[model samples]
Target: MNIGVIGYSGDKNLEPVKSLKNICFEIGKLIAENGDTLLTGGRDGIMDFVCESAYKNNANVVGILPWDEEGNKYLNTTIKTGLDFSMRSFVLLKSVDIVISVGGQVGTALEILGAYAYKKPIILMRGTGGWTDTVTKTLIEDKYLDNRKMVELYQAYNIEELSQHINNLRGDVNL
Candidate 1:
């Protein structure tokens, strides 16, 4: 299985949360141990860290760049596959049986939305920025992630719990 890891890039003045990066690495390791490939944005911050960790553990890494070759010069050479973002999201989510949203910005949130729209299994790492906190919590408070449609919405505070949830998911018609 390929688990798509999503998070914000710590570029220039922006910075990703420390706890988020740690969780991403831990989750990356678990994906490796399970012999599953990992997919990410293919740059620095969460993407670089997650892909590097997974690579160290001998897991295949796929990088979906938000831009073309011009935008990927900063991307790590560790990626096994680097593709354009517009075409990549569909391919990335389809290739993965599940998706884990780490620390993110609007971009990561879009990935989550795509995964959900496709009926793919999704795990949101709580406490990260973007839709991770705002959207789901509101939905949970308003009673959205608790019904039959929620068979695909999963949330975890840490990497271990996320992996456990992935291992336990079953009977879903998609992903």
Candidate 2:
């Protein structure tokens, strides 16, 4: 499966959280070990950490860029989408089976909303800060995004929970 990870890009003078970085590494490793491909925005911050770790573990890391520029070295394939940031995000989400948000600001929130609109499953890593915690703890009715329940939203407070969620999805089950 192609799992998409969206989070703080650290491009707006915001610093990357220490714990979130560790979570990104572990998440990448887990995805690779599960024989899944990792997809990201193809830039720095969370994207770099996850892609590097996944690539080191012999996973196929695909980076979707907002521009026609080169991506990080760890990516096995770099897709220069030529679209702007917001447009690139929709493309990324549409191409993935599942979406995971680490710590996010405006950009990540947009991706999550897009995923919901696309009816793609979403897993939010809680306690990492930003929208991951906000969206998981609030704005969700039970595990649904809205009255329509566009898609089931999941929260993973730790790596174990994240792994279990992935496993359940692997079996074509919804949590």
Candidate 3:
């Protein structure tokens, strides 16, 4: 399974929100342990955390880069889209079977919308704040977006629940 993780790029200092970073790292570790691939925007913040953790665990990591820039060192396969962020975002969303939204701003909102449009299953890690928190509060009710009942949206408050959700989807009966 190719799981895409979307979130903020943060500042140049890469001062991360400790809790969110830890959750992302744990998610990455779980993904790797489950023998799944990790996809990201190929930038910083939550994306960096997940990709790095996955790489450390010897999992395949793909990065859909926005431009022809140097890709993240942890990426196993880096696709230089040569397109702007918006276009690159589409590629990232299209390449993943599932999306995990940690904490994000406007860009993360766009990725979530893209996942909805693509009919991809999404797991919103609640308590991560930013658009994820907002979406969990209002946009999604009963695991479906308003007027879009076909969309699959799951909420995971922690790493264990997130792993269970993904494992269940993968038909891991033991889960």
Candidate 4:
């Protein structure tokens, strides 16, 4: 199985950085131990940290980059396969069996939409940043994900809880 990690960008803060790094390591370790591959956008911030951790853990890590040229090298080094991010969203969605959305921005929102369309399992890590706080509102207030035949939404605030919730959703095709 492949677990994709989605997060925000251009965000720089000591606590957020520390949290992202820790979550990256934990997610990498979990994926390695569980014999699952790790996937991400492979950019700076959370994507970079997680990709680095996955590489360190010797797990198969794929980076779906948003660029086609020599770009975002800081995080691209750890990626096993680097695909054009915008053009390869379909491949990324198909590559991952489950998606763990840590934090988000516009790109992350689009990732969520792609995952939803593909009928994949998604775990939302709340309080991280970006659209995390707006997920419940988006689904309930806007009915974005309501009454869907497939697609599971699990909200968590930390890496441990997020991991557990993902494990719990291993059996359910959708939430």
- Leading candidate by lDDT: 2
The 0-to-1 C-alpha lDDT of every candidate, in the order given, reads 0.68, 0.86, 0.83, 0.69
Q: Write the per-residue lDDT of candidate 1 for residues 20-100, one digit (tens) a residue.
A: 657667877898898877777676777766776788888877776554432223233333335555456666777777888
Per-residue lDDT over 55-164 for candidate 3, one digit per residue giving the tens place of the 0 to 100 score? 99999999999879666688999999999888899999888888899878898999888888988888999888888778876654658766767677888998889988
Worst 10 residues of 3 by lDDT: 10-19
- How far residue 6's Cα lies from its native spot in candidate 4, in Å, is 1.2
* Model 3 error, position 163 (Å): 0.6
- Which 10 successive residues of model 2 have the least lDDT summed? 10-19
lDDT of 3 at 53: 93
Candidate 1's C-alpha runs over 4 A off are: 12-14, 17-19, 70-87, 140-151, 170-175
TM-score of each prediction: 0.78, 0.93, 0.91, 0.78
Candidate 1, clashing residue pairs? none
Per-candidate Cα RMSD to the true structure, in Å, reads 3.9, 2.5, 2.8, 3.9
Off by over 4 Å in 4: 11-19, 70-84, 141-144, 172-175
Whole-model lDDT, model 1: 0.68
TM-score of 4: 0.78
